[model samples]
Target chain A: MKYVDEFRDPVLAKSLIKQINILVEQIDFAKERPIQLMEFCGGHTHTIFRYGIEQLLPKCIELVHGPGCPVCVLPMGRVDDCVSLAERPEVIFTTFGDAMRVPGSKKSLLQAKADGADVRMVYSPLDALQLAHKYKDREVIFFALGFETTMPSTALTVLQAEADGLENFSLFCNHITTVPTIKAILDSPGMQLDGFVAPGHVSMVVGEQPFHFVCEKYKKPIVITGFEPLDILQSIWLLIKQIAEKRCIVENQYARVVQPDGNFPGLDAISRVFELREFFEWRGLGSIDHSGVRMKDDYARFDAERKFPVPNVRIADPKSCQCGEVLKGVIKPWQCKVFGSQCTPETPMGALMVSSEGACAAYYNFGNLPELMALKAEREKEEALS
Target chain B: MTASVPGMRKRSGVLRAETINMSHGGGGKAMRDLIEDVFIGAFDNNELSMLEDQARIELSTLTALGDRLALTTDSYVVDPIFFNGGDIGKLAVCGTVNDLAVGGAVPLYLTCGMIIEEGLSVADLRIIVASMKAAADAAGVKIVTGDTKVVDRGAADKVFINTAGVGVISKAHKISAHNAKPGDVVLINGYIGDHGAAIVGARGDLAIENDIQSDCQPLNKLIQSLLQACPNVHCMRDATRGGVGSVLNEFAVSSGVCFKLRETSIPVRTEVRGMCEILGLDPLYLANEGKVVVVLPKADAEAALAAMKSNQYGVNSAIIGEVTDAPTDTVILQTSFGGERIVDMLVGDQLPRIC
Candidate 1:
């Protein structure tokens, strides 16, 4: 609570909001459109919504929820692969609770579990290893999902498994790097231009250097910000000042937790265990080259994909879902043809709707509650008239 | 509880088994002896002491209490049966009691049925049974009838409890989720997320455990005080499995109204909040065993809050929010930062967001 309490101080939040308002007014570019700032991590998206940071900020600044949620970005094919491996008789599947709901081509892991599979939710990779130790006869496979924020831990877990000579344990690595995904978003055509808020936890591992291209080449101010109410406000203020002063640089607003040089040992651990795949699939966004990481050759003995021999099929995104546009900031979630009318949190048709962190799902679940009430009433009235 | 069984005659055939086996549920002498020694010996009421296949009560007795009967049932399969504050037996009774109480009823009797796993220690079973007796006495209800079964070792968890309860609702009392109107006040009893944090922390695998305990208790006494002070209370519900968020969502959709809850007004202990932060869970969505959501008209809000404050369970009761008519079917939270967002139900269980 010591470190967490200070970051959520309402007093500090108010002062930061005031400073942000002042900076936004000075940087009022043409006053016709608002300044677009994107936070590239789902952790920040969750904090922004949980604390209502977007509502506290001035109307001219908009925070675009980026493609940082690993579950949101994972394609249906990968989930199917996980399910195929999990469905085997002698295998025990383990995954984070968040990924259990992501829909596959056939079904999600939760569905597989309900269908009499041995899928389980574990908080960490180490918990999965413990299950392997407990059940010596069964094969334990961990669905290692997330970006660099979780890469070091999974890498360390695999190392621990090898050191303990645990051969029954393996990893279904879906860990992705943030650099390629960010660059893909930047290169996507027709995105309204503004600064960015880089992911805080990912920066702690990969360092500030991975985000320099967005500022140096794209000439957009990017701040490596923490996921707290006050931290978000201060980072917005920093981005606004940079835009007003015509400066493009990567600043660390969360200097307390993140380092400019990053965690060296964590990066080293990750490199030792993982190697880049030629092409790894994304849910909304199509497959990107060198975007995902797989188990290294040295760690091949601990790879679930190789150990289990799953039917790794490729599945395409649903044509009706506009998640691709939403991820790249091409359109708002409500602009999609099937946002609430056809797609919902309960029966999600798109990958974005599967997880709360996805931009479309967040807007559908959290955005415009009062307005949605009116919308529901109008629809009911229309139904009555019909 | 002084374990002196002075009332019920002791069955001379007390079996000698340290742990239960399949024969204990065989409907033979072993089964009866286990029930008499464990349940009937602990409860020791005239109705249960009879040991009849079914409990028989006069119809006039129920008719005299109220015009209608409220019957409710709940099943308890909580892991780590022995938690910091209470066990599964206590939860089994409190859950069914609260279910009946929230319907504007005075709970009268309960029936408990347990499915225990083989190889479970008999000592642990006795402790759990004793706990149920204490809870039933506190709620002023009788555990009139019960049953038990033993399954193979891997077939069931240590123990699973199912409770069915009957209560009488007076003709004058009217409580429903659809009864809430605009300008109504929302109130909650005590701190939220104690039960959820306690269970998750008690798991001990997360390594984020603290001194948090479950807030599991019977709410019949608290409900009685609220109805006495403000008979026009719109709605009452215990925030159970999905916590306050799930119950509030049901209220909004059922009544076709919206709610604006003040986040700061919702009382939660510091430790629970810290544990939630560590696990990336929202306390509003966490489970609470001893908390209830009370909604009443603005005119009766003050009296209801005063009555709740006088009771043991509702001592920390506070008015947390207000009902609105515009945002129908939406529950919004006025965040501590003076901003608002919709509090939507999680698609599945609440999972942590990766940074």
Candidate 2:
């Protein structure tokens, strides 16, 4: 609690809130419409809701939860591929605990596990490699999924496997890049984002240079933010000050961890094992160019997609889901048609409702449910009449 | 040929197998040997020693304690059968005892049932049985009757335990979840989330090293003292699987009042907090083995706190929150930060977040 408690000081948070309030008043554009800031990482969104930071902020500032949670953005067809891989008798499928619950076209990995597949939850890809070493006879497939924050570790894990010449281990690589997704969001129609709070962990791996485009091209202020309540509050204050002074620049609020040039060894590992895919399908957002990474041809033997027969089919999102608008900051999660009625944490219908890091899940879990439900009812009645 | 006959030899059984097999559950000599040497050897009480199909108690004994009987049962399937503070056996005994105690009952007797996998070591079985006996003795409860079964290696975990307890509730105590009112205060016995954190550490999947131990103790003594000081306790529940959060939610819904908890007043160990932070888990929702949530009138809050603090298991007890009149049937938390949020019931298991 040493580092954590310091970041959550109530006194400091109050002062930061006061500063944010003062800055919002100085900005002339705030009188007309609320200034919207997007926290791109799902981790930051979790922090915002966990500490009730959104409630403490002034009404003039709005925080938009972005599509940074890897599990939430995983397309259904990829989940089906994971399920199919897990169901094979000769293979043992390992994945992060949260990914097990993501629904596929047929069934989730949890359901497949319940139906007698050898599915296991692991904290790291190395744990999957350990299983490969222990079993030796059966194939061990690690469902490697995450943004650049997790990519380095998985890449290093692949390097370890190769060094040890472990034959039974392979990766179902679904690693994604962060910059291109941000670009896609910037290019989105009706985009009204004022500033950006970039993911700290992802920034740690891939330096501040990658985020310069947001300021250079899009003319937006971006802060590489940490996933603590104080860090988030301070980042918001920084963004507000940038807006008040009419400046656009990339800044680092989490200077303690994220290096300006980024982690060299980790970036080296990522480039060594993975290459950018031409396009990758997001769960709610459609295919974005160069948004995903796959194991390079040199590591083809270590790729589960190549070693095993994957269905490799594309499945469309559900008809009722409005996760795209939620991700783009166009509408609040509760404003979605199926938010609480047809979609919930227990039986999620959209990607945003799946992971706790997802905007909808965060709202459902921490927000006042009765109020949201009442709002949903009002909206339904209005829709019925109109 | 009856063993009760004078000068008749008592046939004591002996077990030679090192590991459990199907024969241990076949209702044969091996099974009898296991029961006699492991269970009966440790849980040595007059009622259990009688070796009858049912444990018989005197009607007068039951009548003397209270006007009504309380019965509760719980199953223990913890992944690691053994943990830092307790094992599945101790958990089985204390879990059922606490269940009865929270109902303002004087816990008296317990029945244990075990389903073991084929490859479980006999030595491990002996240790587990001894742990159960030790827990029951400390709680002043008798393990009166039990059963055991063995299955194939892949059919079950290494071991699973089920305990059903019986106690007598005094006629004077009228504790119920619906008894809470607006002016009631919320109290917790001690530090929570220790047992949950210990289990996560013991599992070793995350490789996080910590000195946290499970707070897995019988709370009957603490409950007895608490009820003695505040006989008109409004509601009581052990925060087991879902920690204090789930219990508070149940209290709010049943009493139709709001329970506003101050985050700073809640006692959570630094180690548990750190672990939760690293794993993206909420300590409020973590499981506790020996913690209890007590709701009572504001006037009796001090006496109740004093009584709880005097008990062995309640030294760190504190009044964490108070009941509110409006926002009916909701649980809110005044966060450590100067903010508030709704603490809703968890839909399913709290999965670790992908950082």
Candidate 3:
């Protein structure tokens, strides 16, 4: 608790909040209109939503969610591959719980599980190793997912499986790097990003180098922040300062755990097992070149994609869902038509509603259905007034 | 030549290779026979032999306090065997003891049962046992009895712990979900989701390095201090399996009142929030090992907050919400945008294998 508790000083947080409020009020009233800031990390977006940080800010400032969630950006074709692997009899599909509910082709991993595919929810890639050892007769394929923060673990699992001489396990690697995704977001048409709240966990592994592209090329202020309320608040305060001064650079607010170099051991393992794919299809972003990692040639024998026969299922997002615009910071969770009505955490229509890091899901969980609530409230008021 | 008795027929060389298989949880003669032959044999105690789903215990007549006590039982199943903050052993004991403590009980004794998988290193087992001993000693509670069983290697994970604790409750300590009243203030001990995040980070799965450790500890002393400082405390509940939201829902239903929470008031660690966001999880629904949700009368709310802050475990404690009169038997959240939302009970599993 020594290193952990110090970051959450209530007294310091209060003073900082006071300073931020005063600063917000003092900004040029007529010179600048709404100061639009985009937080590129899904984690920061959720913190901003969960802690109600946006509601605390002045009306002159508008915060937008960026294309940061790896799962939301993942395309339908890759999910089809995982679903096909789940259909195989000799395989046991292991994945994070969020991926289980994400719709693939005609069904999801959860649907596949219900249909008698040996699907399991694992907390880590190590648990996948345990499953492989337990079911030695069958194949255990991990549906590897996530950004730089989770890729190293899948890489380690592969290396450890090879070292242990376990042939029944494989990785269906969908590991994507962070830098390219950020570039894709910024380069996209009509991209309006003033600054970014860089992901803390990803920065811990990639360590501020990959994000340099955003600073040098785009001139967008980027603040790598931790996931706490104070961390997000502090990062926002930093971002606002940078924007006000017309300076753009990568600043690290989470210095305690994340170093400039990052943890070398994890990176070494990742470099050993994975190689960058030239072009990979992201669900919303189409195909971003050099955006994702696939199993290296040496590990192909353990790769489920090679072992299993899966049709290259090219699918499109539901015509109504504006996930692309949502991910790119052009729209908010409340702006989505499927936010609380047709698409919810219980019955998700897209990956955005399924993952906990998904902006739509977080907003729904914390109650962003103001229109519905207001309607009910007005009815009650009218009944009393009459 | 030495003559061997039937009981001594199996020697070190003749011992069967140990492995955990699924039959251990099958609820058949294989489980019972294994329990009696291996587990009971190793443990060898009278309390375990009673063989009831519920434990029945008697207080020491020497310090008989004339009042009935509170009882709580908890089960722990964390993966990777160990973590950065603490291991399964420490979590098992602290979890159960904290439950009884927040229920306004003076934790006195505990009973533990271990379901250990075959092929687990004996050295690892020893470390866990030592951790349990240390945590119990720190809490001033005795592990009077315990049970141990080794299953086939595939049958169980490394180890799973189930601990039930008994504590003496004073008559003055009138606290339960049913006791919450309108105008009562809701408070949390500190930040939520630290234990869940630490366990996840310890797995080395996310590739993110977090200095975050599990906030797993005993809160009996803290609860006792709060009780003494403010006897008018209406309700108390530990934020455990379903986090703060679940506990608040329980209070609302039991007290037949509505509840409202402030979005800006809740405390959460940045590292945890980051992990939760990346993983698509909600801190409101994530588990906490040492956090609690309490409702107290407005008159004693300040006193209760001061008392909680006096303890090391409750340093970041703050009044987050209050009991309300609308939507009886439901819990609502007051969004920072001046909107109202329902904070419902946990449906199914949120985060599993996270103790």
Candidate 4:
């Protein structure tokens, strides 16, 4: 609670909001249209909604939830591969708890488990490694997912497995890179994002150097932000001040954790274990170059994809889902067609509706339903008139 | 009729097996020995000692306590049967007793049924039975009748317990979820989510080390005292599987009213909060075994709080929220950060986030 309570202090949050309001007043773009800033991490999106930070901020600024949740962006084909691997009698599939609910082509891992698959939820990859050691007869496959924030741990675990001469341990690598996906978003046509609130955890691993492209090349202000209400409020203030002053640069609002050069040992481990894939498929945003990683040839023994038979078939997103638009901040989640009706957290039809970190699921679960419905109706009316 | 009498035959049987097997549930001498040694030894009472097929309760005896009977049942299949603070046995007894108590009843009798996987150690079963007996004694309830079955090793978990309880409600008290009205203050006995956190920690999957213990105890004594002080209690429920959030939602939907809870007022232990923060879980939706959600009029709020505070189980009792008229069938939380969010019923089990 020492580190947590201080960041959640309401007094500090109120003071930061006052500063953000003053900065918004000075920016001329606010009078014409709302200054839309995007928080690129699902963790930040969660904090924004959990603390109701959007409702507290001035109306001139709007926060767009981004597609940084790794679970939310996972393609269905990969999940299908996971289910197939888990169903194998000789394998033990272990994954983070949230990933168990992501629907594959046939069924989610939860369903596969109920149907007699050996799927287990583990906190860390090391736990999976331990299972491999305990049950040497069974192959333990860790469903490796997340961004750079989690890459190091998975890499270190793989290295540990190698050192221990673990033959039965392998990784279902879905680890993605942050900078390329951010680049994809910046390159998106009709994108009107004013600035960016970069993920704090990812920055802690890869550091501010990776995000320099957003400011230097794209000329957009980007602040590395933490996953706390006060951290988000302060990051918003930093983004707005940069806009008001006509300055574009990468700033670290979570300086206490995120260093300028990033973590060296973690980076070293990652580089040793993994290499960028030619092109990786995302659920909503399809086929980003060098966005995902696979185990290097040296560590091929630890790669589940290479070691086991997988049904690696491509599956497209539902036609009714507008998750791509939502990910690009082109439309709010409620503006999507099947948001509350066909697609819900209970029975998600889209990847964005599957995970709590997903934009649509976050809005559906945390946003006021009555208010969202009214907004959706108003938006539909405006679109009809146009 | 007494075993101590000089001419009376010794009714107690001695069990010699180290572990339970199919024979223990075969309804033969092995079954009789198991019942007499393990269960009857711990839960000793005249009614249970009779070994009848069913527990026979005199109508006059039940009438003496209250006018109406309250019957409720629950099954416990918690993993890691033995956890910090309590075991599955204690949970079985307390769960059923609290269900009856929440309805303004004086819990008196419970019927236990167990389905156990074969190859379980007899020593472990004794420990569980002793825990159940101790919990029953604390709640002033009798385990009058029971049944047991054994399945093949892979058929079931180590053990599963089901308890059905009977209690009598007085004519003066009429507590129901539908009775909640606007301006009624919502109160809880103590900190929430301890039992849930303890279970998660005990499971060892997360490998998080902490001293958190389950708050699994009977709430009958506390409820009785509260009812005496505030007889007009409108709604009451044990925050069990879904914690306080689901209970509030149920009250809101049933009464066609809204509950506005104060985030700062709700009591959550620091350790539990830490666990929730780490796992991306909301303590609001975590499970609680001992906590109870009470709703009553504002005028009697002080008396209810005082009555709860005086009881051992309700020492940390506090008013958490109040019922409101508008926004019917919704539960809202005024966050500590000066914002409000709807507290909806959980769609499914709360899964831990990847990050």
How far in Å is the alpha carbon of A117 misplaced in model 2?
1.5
DockQ comparison, 1 vs 2, better candidate: 2
Candidate 1: segments with Cα more than 4 A from true spot:
A28-30, A370-386, B1-13
Q: What is the DockQ (computed on Cα atoms) for candidate 4? A: 0.63
Clashes of 4: 0
lDDT of 3 by residue, B1-355 (tens): 3566644544212212244345544675545655555444444445555666644566564147428766788888888769877899889889999988887788888888888887676557657767887788779887766666767767788899999988887877788789888888999999998887886788776576788888888898899899899977788878877888888888888999988888669898877877765665667888788888889988898998999999999999999988888667666666543335557666456743110
Kindly provide the TM-score of model 2 when superposed on the true structure, using C-alpha atoms.
0.96
Candidate 4, residues B148-226: lDDT per residue as tens digits? 9999998999999999999999998989999889999999999999999999989977878878999999999999999
lDDT of 3: 0.77
Pitting candidate 1 against candidate 4, the one with the higher lDDT is 4
Better of 1 and 3 by lDDT: 1
DockQ of 2: 0.69
**Per-prediction tally of clashes:** 0, 0, 18, 0
Collision pairs in model 2: none
What is the per-residue lDDT of model 2 for residues B235-338, given as tens digits with 9 covering 90 to 100?
Answer: 99999998899999999999899999999999999889989988888999999999999999999999999999999999999999999986777888989997
Query: How do the candidates rank by lDDT, highest first?
Result: 2, 4, 1, 3
Error of 4 at A109 (Å): 0.6
Task: Kindly list the per-residue Cα lDDT of model 3 for residues A226-252, writing each as its tens digit.
Answer: 977788778878887877777899999
Tens-digit lDDT string for candidate 1 (B1-355)? 3466644445344757899999999998888788888888888898998879999888898999889999999999999999999999999999999999999999999999999999999999989999999999999999999999999988999999999999999887899999889999999998999999999878887877687889999999999989999999898899998899989999999999998899989999999888788777899899999999999999998999999999999899999999999677788998877678999875667776554
lDDT of 2 by residue, A108-177 (tens): 9989999999999998898999999999999999999999999999999999999999999999999988
Candidate 4 local distance difference test against the native:
0.92
Q: What local lDDT score does residue A381 receive in model 3, on the 0 to 100 scale?
A: 93
Give the top-scoring candidate (DockQ). 2
